[model samples]
Target: MRRYPSLVMLMLACSVAVTACKPAPQAMPVDPEPAAPATTAAAATPAPVPARNECPYPKFDAFLKHFGNEITLQEKATADPLLDSHIDAEAEPEPRKVESRLALADVEWPVMPDPAALAGQGRELQVNTLADGQRQVQIRTPDSSDQQTYTFAQAPCWTLVKREDESI
Candidate 1:
């Protein structure tokens, strides 16, 4: 897929924003009073370590940069048997809601739109971090109902799990 100038600018801006918003590492405050020594019994029993999500690249912005630009990375990051939901345009009298799974082998490459291309075509792109912690990337034509939303979840690392096509 060709890279558009607008898309490059968008990604660059996102990168800068993410970098700018990161909090600087601060030095741990020094305690005037020393912490109490643990008892021998307490030392014998090791404190339980909290489990953590170990995804190397946990930031959605970074993941999205690759997702839009690289097909192989997108395929690898997407969930297998992806949940695809949309209106079935083939219905006899009227379109009907349909839900299906697209196995990794069956998925058409580059399902995601290039934001630059969309902008060039006079479509608008909106990205939101939903209340439920999922990220939604939506593209639509202004003043029109033509829209699609791609929902992603951080299953350890970001993964494209659902797509909702609302376009007519």
Candidate 2:
């Protein structure tokens, strides 16, 4: 009876040791994680949009009317049109004299002459949208007048781009 008890205890210990040394059963196969929700076309691609809107000028006169009018100039924020770039590439170029009525629109401007209200001074201001899609405003003062041409190609605002004294 004593030997039978010892034999039973040895067998139980051997079985427990064998089970502990055995590798854990492999995990059962599962559905491939739902295929990660397929990437939609909209999610993968970006929307196409134009960089800038077309220039909005019905008539050049109406557009430049903002230049001579005090209230109009204030509403536009920019007294004179922005100069995107200069036409002449000279290192030291002569100053382009734009008229006072229009020049005074930019009060703090130092280089340009913003004299007294000269709209009543009888200066012929001509604005035209060129065939190349730039709005050209020409200001012709008496004989000493310079060829100062402005362009508004980038936006609705005018830009003084070209100037050559006595060219016109």
Candidate 3:
């Protein structure tokens, strides 16, 4: 009986020792290329183009006509008045919230009309000329009550047109 207990204890000790003495698994090799010093000259990055100050003066009537078609299609597909109401209810009354939620409510991403089609329509496509000569175009929906302002070189063009204003 004494010998049996000692043999079991010795077996346990041997197993523990074998496990403890086992060598740690080697780590997989990694590529050293990323750490290598760059030998070639650093490529020169191009300077960023400054934003244009003027809006593109597109043919407003033609642009609106094209935009209207796109808006109509979009409205037919996913203009959920119920969803709009829910969004409005959850939205904060802040100006940014109103602007973001309502800005596109009435407009869709306008399709770029072909240059030839625009020419056939007898409409000139001029982008809003920024002070820096970059052209931009903005679309305002009829529900927008906020005054939209565009600035060129810190100069402001206030009271351009209201959403209800048909002058565009």
Number of backbone collisions per candidate, in order? 0, 0, 16
lDDT of 1 at 38: 47
Q: For residues 20-47, what per-residue lDDT tens digits would candidate 3 score against the true structure? A: 8886666434665654444332334555
- Which one is best on TM-score? 1
Compared with the true structure, the alpha-carbon lDDT of candidate 1 equals: 0.80
Pick the winner on TM-score between candidates 1 and 3.
1
Where does candidate 1 stray beyond 4 Å? 1-56
- Name the 10 consecutive residues with the lowest summed lDDT in model 2: 109-118
Better-scoring candidate (lDDT), 1 or 3: 1
- In model 1, the number of clashes is 0
Which model is ahead, 2 or 3, in terms of lDDT?
2
Q: What tens digits encode model 2's per-residue C-alpha lDDT throughout 62-89?
A: 4455444444343343434333333342
Q: Scored by CA lDDT, what does every candidate get?
A: 0.80, 0.47, 0.36
TM-score of 1: 0.62
RMSD of each: 29.2, 11.4, 14.3
lDDT order of candidates, best first?
1, 2, 3
Query: Largest lDDT belongs to which candidate?
Result: 1
lDDT score, candidate 1, position 87: 80
